[model samples]
Target: MRYKRSTQERSLTSPARTTAPHVKKNVDRYGTTKLGKAAEKGDLEAVKQAYEQSPDELNQPDYAGIAPLQKASLKGHAGVVAYLIKQGCRPDVQDDQGDTPLIDAVTNGELDVVRILLKHGVNPHHSNSNGQRAMDFLE
Candidate 1:
């Protein structure tokens, strides 16, 4: 015989989910960098300044390996994502957990950002360390 679960029982039995370790480190690192700040704010000018002063910053990841593209994409900054891509940023660049900008945009429900990332040829089939794809995050 099988038993149906009560609402309280169901809630208690559900597994607790947490952000990956590197993702938290990425967040911490992002809040302290000019490029990460610019990307989070969608500030193209600041981004350009950072890039001009050090082109390598574009590809520079936080200690946790979150790049500017990932930061911009996570914040739903379509303009920043576009400009970064135009300036040679790789859309498919992944964080330590294998989460790409496309995954970030999709997870955030940023449709415009998703379109921009897709236009840049981000792989839709890519999965993160948890094995979740961009589509998995879609409503």
Candidate 2:
């Protein structure tokens, strides 16, 4: 005999359950730069040190075409995102998939990071290679 599942269990196994595509796309790529790694980990201090050691690398993308800002936004690292923007990292920089930090933050449900990007004047209407706008990811 089959037993009825609780609401929480049903939710966990529901067809509505979904993972952000960008999270899967970027997480498996271990070839990120030092800044990208620190940003992904949300280590603001380490990000600062990494930037100090190589300021020019701040806007550089890793082998996966993901930059530090994108990683920070992906992981909802609001402070790191703020710091990167303050230090002149382009808020609209797109990865190989044409996703900006704004797109990354929105897709990952990082509201704070999304707010930070918007407050800093990121282009919300920018579309990724898939032709989806950042606002399209809002739940």
Candidate 3:
């Protein structure tokens, strides 16, 4: 369901880098440009480089509103997951479908990922599109 925008779309939506004197409003200055996929695949080096170039990329939501940290959790990428949390990514960020990282981790039976996210205070009670909580997925 993740679609890569065409060059024309990227150009059209790319925000103008404004100075302090001319702040733009209601624009996602930081765009999701394959970093979320890299994070989900647990490529720490790619994640590192992406963050180095645009640390704000960590906060950028995909069209589905899924954050990179959430993808990392769903894929059970522990190293990237840890690094993302240390970098201040919220473990409880919900996607447009209301699915948090904890929800994915639990449903995938990834106990370690669930533990790490819980340590970061991700709500186990957070429901997803199906109205199911993380605890509901626990065995």
Best by lDDT: 2
Candidate 3, residues 1-139, lDDT tens digits: the string is 8998543333234343222211112224443445676797899999888888667667666555678988888888988988999998877788878989888888898888888988888778777888889888878
For model 3, which pairs clash?
none
lDDT tens digits by residue: candidate 2, 10-127: 1122234332333324333444567788998999999999888767667777655678999999999999999999999988988879999999888889999999999999889998
Per-candidate TM vs. native?
0.76, 0.77, 0.75
Q: Worst lDDT window (10 residues) for model 2?
A: 9-18
Please tell me which predicted candidate would have the highest TM-score against the true structure: 2
Model 1 vs. true fold: TM? 0.76
Which residue pairs show collisions in model 2? none
RMSD of each: 12.7, 13.5, 8.9
Higher lDDT: candidate 1 or 3?
1
lDDT of each: 0.77, 0.81, 0.74
Lowest summed-lDDT stretch of 10 residues in model 3? Answer: 17-26
Per-residue accuracy of model 1 over 4-83 as CA lDDT, tens digit each:
75433111111332333333333342333566768878999998887776565676666566889999999998889999
By lDDT: ranked, best first: 2, 1, 3
Give the winner by TM-score: 2 or 3.
2
